[model samples]
Target: MTNTHLPKPEARRQLLLQLLKQHKQLSIHEMTRQMGCSEATVRRDLDLLEQTGEIFRTAGGARYDDPLRGISFHEKEQLFWKEKEAIAAKAASLVQQGDIIGLTGGTTTFLIARALKDRHEITVVTNAVNIAMELAESKKIQVVLTGGVMSNETFELSGPLAEAKLDGLHINKMFIGIDGIHHQNGISTHSELEARMTSIMMSRADRAIAVFDGSKANKSSIFHISPISSLEAIVCNTPLPAELQEACARDNVTLHIADGEPDAL
Candidate 1:
């Protein structure tokens, strides 16, 4: 008889972390091959690991959920920390006492939500579960969530249900984050459903402000969310690329570059 018994769950989890630590990220199929298990078993392990904050699930793989390697939201928050905070502060200053703001999910907007926690008499509508929870302690700031299925990668709610929640509402300002921004390619994101939700927010708001860092400048992503012309303002913590600067000028979009290292230009 052939020996086919698999390792215990705890031992398997330890092995999973070891694999993630070695490879940075691995897909379900890869895990299955390595562990000699079914894809479903791999997925279950990933889910359990994620619940314990041991790993972060990506679009098709799992990463160590570490600040150094994970591309998930938590790991992203550790990258360019100062730049993001500066952008958040500048973005927060633009809000008035009673503005109704719409914030989309991403590290930048998450910081923006935190920056506004002290303000009073403002309404914030968001699709991020983390952002909503961050602002929950503030009695002055009203946080509304778009009801939908939650995304494991972003901890954001999406799909048609979330999109429908924004239809009847009007916003004074919409602060959005993107995966990439280019003069010709326009704004782009990694998720198609998230892109659709962003489009809806842009159309419903009076002023659409993009809050992102310099790394995204001139880069392009898979899903194009909106044209460059859709933005009224952009808050970034790095010097704008010449093309982006010129595009902002030509389009009459106000560009606010936060204070940062000269290289960020």
Candidate 2:
């Protein structure tokens, strides 16, 4: 026994990681029975995986991380331009003139900024470098950049500084971009700091809107930012679930399903 003194939890965790890497997903019940461990132990191990961003926790199992590793602004914009714009359009309609809006980082929020060019008297606050750069040209709206540490991969600013800057402002509406949105997991992002600021922004705003396409729904991500119930609206494409619609109605959150066209909607 080269390492006989090693703790059982450590050995079981390593084994669990190996199985997860091999299968790309593993259920709690299966892992518990196979590892000869308690249910609580298996759950704790899976929770560790979730914290490390190695896997996304689900109802009874975990899903594999994104194949490409992480998301980038250019890649996200290229990946789902139409759906993002449609979702953004729906989100934009929820904002009235003279509103103070808090927009999140990432391409989806950038699309919302682009869609709001014609809207008047709106003061936009954000930590997205790209969105700030884009909105800088808008004479109709005031763009406030929350100063903070920036993520080179996504080109978004997130950190203690951003959070501090955001704490000073109150907004009428907030639009956030989530990595995944499961009915159980709610809103999640890969970056912990991004999640923190997003949660703060939601709390600071009068109305919170989560904007993402259908691809984001029915999925969970590594870092959970906030619950779905916190938002006042969920904007997405068509074919939404009846259960989700009922849930939103019960939450008093408007669920906008934008198929296409401005007048048709």
Candidate 3:
């Protein structure tokens, strides 16, 4: 039997997605029973999940549709959004005028781009098309976009062309967003090409900081970017685990925790 405790709307939808993944498909009655919610609530959740392209609605049920690449940018933008905004605010506070900043692609870093949009005399060097577009109209902030094929999943430019562009330029700071961060394996992402591009960005920057929410803590993805010791600092919404905290301290990595309430930038 499923747990009787009710979850919030977001939590319930996530749980429903997990159930669909395990069963592949599920009838309304089954979901209503397993989720301990009314049939109407189950249907509503299915509709919302379907709209995100994460599931397919059948006549009386739903089926999980695993994304061909990874989660869509639109979908990722919805998850942990407030936390990401808070983290972005904390990151933006570190930027100084005239700083040439490097940004990697992900929802958090995208928010960082948005946070820095109104700043003056700063140049944003990025591989994410979405980020460059976000800062494009800001007359005070110059935007530099790299050249390469873009990833449909991430909208990040990578490969030989992107690497060549970075060879001549330097960044005052680089804020990277990753799929996972582990104390042992360091920071990582799902795509190797994105990882390679992120490493190059790190190498070009005077300071490299990893920005992520608490859920990413202690998790490790498939492609390794750089070790934890390489980071100058980490900005996250929640406190990291003890082991990871110890690792950060040992490596002299500064950990900046953004408060729970997101600040308006």
Candidate 4:
């Protein structure tokens, strides 16, 4: 007897885990189609996985999660490709030749590092493994690494050691990446160690520039990095919320909106 009923809950969840790992993310519709089940069934499966902390749900889909696999840097690099690139371009254009800058870790800042690859005689201090390595091969730029415990998920250095390394250093500009930005709650990132490092970067820079996409606006994350008053300028692909625009104006923060394709991934 060949019974083609839906797989049992345990089997279904295991299958879901494999799907999330294989794709990094999966939407309810896609999962439903793949499993030959209704959307309701897929939702229940996702809910179960999320309860166990095996997945994290975003607005449209679920992201794979575990001790080894957190919010992925690789996934973020491809999430808002054009928007992040545009924001990076705008941020790069703001940098003057020979300026000493600080960059925190994030996919957007990684793009900023790429955008500044050819700039001459610039010194960049960073705690991000990927960003430092990206600029390591450059002849025109000098890269400084903040040695500390590395976060496998983010590929960045953090902790008290990284904070101490920035103690006596000053920057002409600091470009920051945020997991959340709000009109009142301010800028934040998911990890507390990263948030602490970000706050230090803001304090040591003469000008603090925030680089992010539209998706992060009006949201709050687990850890607060800095207040709205810390920003010198903000570069993003979408328009800021009206309240945020007003707040920026009051705080004397310049906002630059770049145009790009909408979020597809």
The top-ranked prediction according to TM-score is 3
Identify the leading candidate in terms of lDDT: 3
Error of 3 at 11 (Å): 23
Query: Residue-wise lDDT of candidate 2 within 193-213, one digit each (tens)?
Result: 778888888888988888887
**Candidate 3 per-residue lDDT over residues 128-213, each given as its tens digit:** 99999999889999899999999887799999999999998999989999977887899988788999999999999989999998
TM-score order, best first, reads 3, 4, 1, 2
The clash count for each model shown is: 0, 0, 0, 0
How far residue 82's Cα lies from its native spot in candidate 3, in Å, is 0.6
Q: Which residue window of length 10 is worst by lDDT in model 4?
A: 256-265
**How large is the C-alpha RMSD of every model relative to the true structure?**
11.4, 8.8, 7.7, 7.4
lDDT per residue for candidate 4 within 1-265, as digits (tens), equals 2224756777777887888988978888888888788888888888777655456676577887543434769867767788889998888888888799899999999999999998899999999999999998899999989989999878999888988899999899899998878888889877888899999878899989889888777766778988898898888998887988998999999887766432210
lDDT of 1 by residue, 76-185 (tens): 87667788999998898888888999999999999999999999999999999999999999999988899999988788899889988988998999999987788888
Query: Candidate 3, clashing residue pairs?
Result: none
Candidate 2, superposed: residue stretches over 4 Å from native? 1-68, 260-265
Question: Given candidate 2, what's the lDDT at residue 218?
Answer: 59
Clashing pairs in model 1, backbone N/Cα/C closer than 3 A: none
Backbone clash pairs in model 4 (N, Cα, C under 3 Å; residues 3+ apart or in different chains), count:
0
User: Cα lDDT for residue 264, model 3?
Assistant: 20
**Which stretches of model 4 miss by more than 4 angstroms?**
1-25, 28-69, 260-265
Predict model 2's lDDT versus the native: 0.77
Q: Could you tell which candidate, 1 or 3, scores higher by lDDT?
A: 3
lDDT of each: 0.83, 0.77, 0.87, 0.83
Give TM-scores for every candidate, taking all chains together and pairing residue i with residue i.
0.72, 0.72, 0.77, 0.76
